[model samples]
Target: MTPPTLMSMMIAGGLIGLGLALLVIWFTPAQPDLNDAVKRLSNTSPHRPDAEASTVNGKERLGIWAMRTLPVGLWAKTPTRELALLRIPLARFYGDKLTYAALGFVIPIGLATFLSLLGLGLPFAMPVIACIALAVVMFFLPNYNAIDDAKKARIEFNRALGAYIDLVALERTNGSGVRQAMETAAGIGDSWVFNRLAEELNRSRWSGLPPWDALHALATELGLPDLDDFADIMRLSGEEGTATYATLRARSAAMRTAMLNDELTEANAIGERMSIPGSLLGVIFMAILLTPSLLRMIPG
Candidate 1:
């Protein structure tokens, strides 16, 4: 075939492929009903239980569609434990992964087309390889992001719990019983972590379960070990009628110390990372300074 005919055919093929992609996207199936999943997980709709639910937007909706339509389950296992810790739904997590993976797959196609139009043709296999590699990275990007978010959340929860412990100790010193102290302390803070604790305490009260038991269950579900320890202390106080004020005060102090230690450790690690680029810059400067001297010493 003549070059003109071949180029025209390629352009036509590209346009047709683009049109088919757009058509598929436009006809993508609606997201499956997540009500049952929500109810089973939290006994509440996605919106009512937390503030995070209120922030759902278009991208999340797209993710929901992807999650429903794509067979992601065959290869990618849902990070259920991490998602629970982050207070993210499994559906949302899967949806996010799908959205990112779709972007990964689409971006290379657009790039290749742009390059080809600019007279910079890549090998036939290059775009295919790039798409697969990018898609895999993007697919797991959400999981890494979720892990980091969960870590920060756990840190915030521990900080808040430390304050909560002190508040509980103060309430105990004011002559409240264990349950009363926990509920009162939880009620005193307006933070979301406090809100969660208060909700669990209220649930326990309504269900006639011990406050500590509720806390233990919440801790287990959310993977908060410090909260579990706090629950253990409360359990001891309730079961043995032991003097808990001193113990709570001690635990609160220990938690504050531990939190401080964690902050220092993280800060030091960050500083170490920041120094690396500066060190590299210094080495590069030294190399530049020495290059002329070394060249002069070399024989012509």
Candidate 2:
């Protein structure tokens, strides 16, 4: 009797919860000021142009809590999402985006389940499943975009660095001391890399550190081995005001060649990777076409 009574209470509580959820989902009034708030935030945060400032759940708060408590949430949320996202590793790779997605999906699913149980005239199971599927897609999409953006940024920076080096090397070959050449080249640079180099040089000049040393520090900070190597050579060349026009020219050429080779190698590698998927798709299509014939060969 006690066990039966407890079960009855649990069912009753679930029913009540579901009813309230449906009411919120179907009849909850939209916030009148939400559009204005979204417009204001969109104007301010270029990073979040399409981002809503306030949902029923604030995105910022959701992101902060989710990222900080991801490990805990991973352990707690045991659903289709756990299975799908685990397979994709989207949560581990893109915690912030995946968390927002999970939040969005879970809110809808919770509401749908509640409405269904509350006898709301809506298809609960289908809507809940669709929400989960949408969440899975959203979780991975941002990671893909972020990875692409990072790759493009690195490529652009590398190109800028190469041009800056060529300019410095040219000035070095024109009889300027290594320090003087670097300053001249930086001044003449028509790009952002040169601008940054100039800024670092200025700091070094004011702080009484050698310009080459400043370049080395900047290289270390930027993880730029090419710039670091150039700085080392310039440091050595500066000791006796040695002219390294030939060496600088050769290195500049080599760096450009290496950059070209690297780009070609990456392109070829991507092509090879794409071929594997295309081949798999071809095999799958062939199998589908031959399925009837293969079935006919088997004794049913």
lDDT for 144 (candidate 1): 89
**195-230 in candidate 1: lDDT tens per residue?**
988888887887688889888888877788899999
Q: Which ten residues in a row have the lowest lDDT in candidate 1?
A: 40-49
**Model 2: how far residue 209 lies from native, Å:** 1.7
After superposing candidate 2, which stretches have Cα over 4 Å from the reference? 1-152
RMSD of 2: 11.8
Candidate 2 versus the native: TM-score?
A: 0.53
- What are the Cα lDDT values of the candidates? 0.78, 0.60
Candidate 1 collision pairs: none
Error of 2 at 298 (Å): 2.8
What's the TM-score of each model vs. the native? 0.81, 0.53
